[model samples]
Target: MSKVILITGASRGFGKIWAEAFLKRGDRVVATGRNIEALQGLSDQFGDQVLPVQLDVNDRQACVEAVNRAKEHFGRIDVLINNAGYGLFGAVEETSEQEARSQMETNFFGVLWVTQAVLPIMRAQKAGHIIQVSSYLGLIAAPVLGIYNASKFAVEGLTETLALEVKAFGINVSLVEPNGYATDWSGESAFQAKPMEIYGPVKDAFQKAVSVPGFFGQPAATAEAIIKLVDAPHPPLRLLLGSFAYPSVRKVYEERLASFEEWKAVSEAAHGSN
Candidate 1:
């Protein structure tokens, strides 16, 4: 069956690749971004199968309207890729409150708003998939990406809870936790806070880390994984892409378990024996 797939931030990066992948597989695509002009090429290439929409996910009303438009145009939305988010790079204190809030507005609330808008249609249809494009930062943390980590962490929580809540309606929600990928994410898409001399070392470390050869892989493989996930009979609650994410997240869990075990005596000592 040709599914109707709507992807935010679809003008470029992983979003664009996913849109192209779905279109190639015979699915109708609703590609949206803040700049719809950038999506013209997809519309030109795919014709009637592509619907370009200008959407700013930060705006709740705009999200609703965009989903409504997609529903009106395609009759049903089978998959929604909440891929509209960016990185806010800097230390916790270095990032201003306004900058931090803006980061949350787009990365966290944006996903929530779009999901809320799409839920009703999915519920009515009794079938749908919501893919939250989170980050390994969501599971763990990075030094200079505290704000970005916080945002994706919130997404992790939101999608996890949403998965359980919407399962009854046959609506599957999954988080796509990809590590560093060759995207505009840390490049043009990222917002760097005003630098402080105190954080120079951290900034330098981040720069060095990113500059490492083969640090980031292309997005084509990631897009293919997502397509396979969508086509699966039962997709997992969380799908980690890229070679780095698997071990990175596994290490986090292993360390977390070890810490818990190490503190088990103290944790149990606080409670009275039953």
Candidate 2:
């Protein structure tokens, strides 16, 4: 059976790759992006299997309308991929108020608004899947990407709670955390903060880390994992893409556990004589 999948940020990158993959397999997609013309190619190639919608996910009302349009056109929405977001690169001290808020608006609040709009429709159907495109930085942290990391961290928390809350309704929620991908996320789609000389060394170190060989994975390689996730009867709460995510995150957890154990006495003392 062909499923109705609604994907945001379909103009390019992972969203476009996954949308085409689904359409090639006969699934219907409600593909959305800020530029409708950029999405036209999907409709052109896939015919009626794709519905291109012009959307700016930061607008809460627009998010709601997009969901309504999908429900009306497809009769039901079987899957939603929240892939509309960009990276904000800068040090914490150098980040301006507007930059931080804008990052939160698109990366964090945008996901919230779209998810809220689709919840009622999915609840009525009694079966649906929500896939959030977060990053491995959501689980760990990276210098010069403080704001982007914060946004994904918020997504990780939100999706984890959503999974638990919607389990009884037969709704599945999964966080797709991809570690450094060779995409335009670091190029045209990215927002850069005004550089400060004090942080030059920090910025340089971050740049060198990313330039290392084999640090990034191919974006198209993720399509198979995403398809498998949506097709699973019982999908995972969190799915980490790319080879770097697993071992890297595992190390972070181990270090966290050790710290927790080291502070066990202090933590217990904080409870006082309750």
Candidate 3:
């Protein structure tokens, strides 16, 4: 029997590719995204096996309904891929509070609601995979990208806690930190701020960093990696994609390790049990 997987942000990018690839391999795909028209087109192309659900994850009720529809369509959802998110570029200080909150709603709380809605069914089944699509930014803080980085960082922590909570029930969770992938990635990045004027030269430099699009690997690579992740018996908790993520992650580790060492004596003194 072919497994059924539900992926969000499935109208484009790696999310779309993953759905298509899974369908090609005989799995049922419940693909959801904010673009109803694009998702409808995918449904038309793939027919019944690909279920394109139009959803705005920021709308809490909409997420619950999407999951219900997935349950109705597939009877059971074997995998849940929280692939929906957009990048908001700006320094933490420069970004508006409203914009930051909205981003968190879509990227973090949206995932939270959907996962909670699906937990009952997954727990009943006693086996499932939860793939949280985070970014390399999840592990590091960039000068001009702190707001975006903050949400992904929260995702990293959330996934870790949820994994521990659900492990005994046989649910597997994997965090995918892909540096960048060739897609409609940049054009779709949400831009919210007064102007780059306040940021000055660094803003221009940051724009330059994000301007080059096709340099990243094809979405196909990420799709393939996600598909493999879903099938693994004991998948790793973290999987870094592309060449860029490895060094980025290593640097984050070193920075964090140094910070920990610097505070070790302070931490030890605070430990009441010690």
Candidate 4:
């Protein structure tokens, strides 16, 4: 059976890759992006299998309309991939108020709006899947990506709760956390803060970390995993893409566990018998 999948940020990056992957497999896709022109190729190639809609995920009303359009076009939405988000590269102190809010608007709130729009339809159908394209930074953190991390962290928490809440409705929620990919995410698609000399060392270290060989994985390699995830009867709540993600997240958790053990007495004392 061909499934109807709605994907945001289908103009480029993993979004476009996954959209084409689905279409090639005979799945219908409602491919959306801020620049519909960038998505025209998909429509040209896949014809009616792809619906390229112009959408700025930051707009709540537009998100609702997009969902409605998908339902009207395909009769039902079987999957939704919330891949419409950009990275904000800047240290905490270097980030401006507008930058932080804009990041949240598009990254966090955008996911929220689109998910909200589709929930009713999925609930009515009693089966659906929602995949949130988060980042490995959502599980951990980095120097210059503080705001970006926060946005993804918010999505992680939101999707986790959503999974639990919608389980009875047969709605599956998964967070796709990729460590680093050879995508335009960190290039033209990213927002950079005004550089400050005080944070030069921090920026340099961050750059060095990402510059290591094999740090970034190929974007196309993720299609198989995504297909398997969507086809699974019981999909995982969190799926980490790339070889770097699991080991990196494991190390972070181990460190966290050690710190928690170290602070066990303090943590217990703070409870005050409550």
Q: How well is each residue in 1-274 modelled by candidate 3, as lDDT tens digits?
A: 7999999998888888888889888899999988778887667877899888888888888888999999998999999999898877777778888988988998898888888878888999999999999888888777677777888999999999999999999899889998877676656555656655667788788668756765477678776788788888999999988877897789879999999999999999898773
Per candidate, the number of residue pairs that clash is 0, 0, 0, 0
TM, every model: 0.97, 0.99, 0.92, 0.99
Tens digits of per-residue lDDT for model 4, 1-274:
9999999999999999999999999999999999999999999999999989999999999999999999999999999999999999998999999999999999999999999999999999999999999999999998999999999999999999999899999899999999999999999999999989999999999899989999999999999999999999889989999999999999999999999999999999998984
Pairs in steric clash, model 3 = none
Q: Residue by residue across 74-163, what tens digits does model 2's lDDT show?
A: 899999999999999999999999999999999999999999999999999999999999999999999999999999999999999999
The list of candidate 1 runs beyond 4 A from truth reads none
Worst 10-residue stretch by lDDT in candidate 4? Answer: 265-274
Residue runs of model 4 more than 4 Å from their true location after superposition: none
Candidate 3 root-mean-square deviation in Å: 2.2
Kindly give the stretch of ten consecutive residues in candidate 2 with the minimal lDDT sum: 203-212
Question: What's the lDDT for all of these models?
Answer: 0.93, 0.96, 0.85, 0.95
True-vs-predicted CA distance for residue 216, candidate 3, Å: 2.2
lDDT of 3 at 113: 82
Instruction: Point out the higher-scoring one by TM-score: 1 or 4.
Output: 4
| lDDT for 222 (candidate 2) | 97
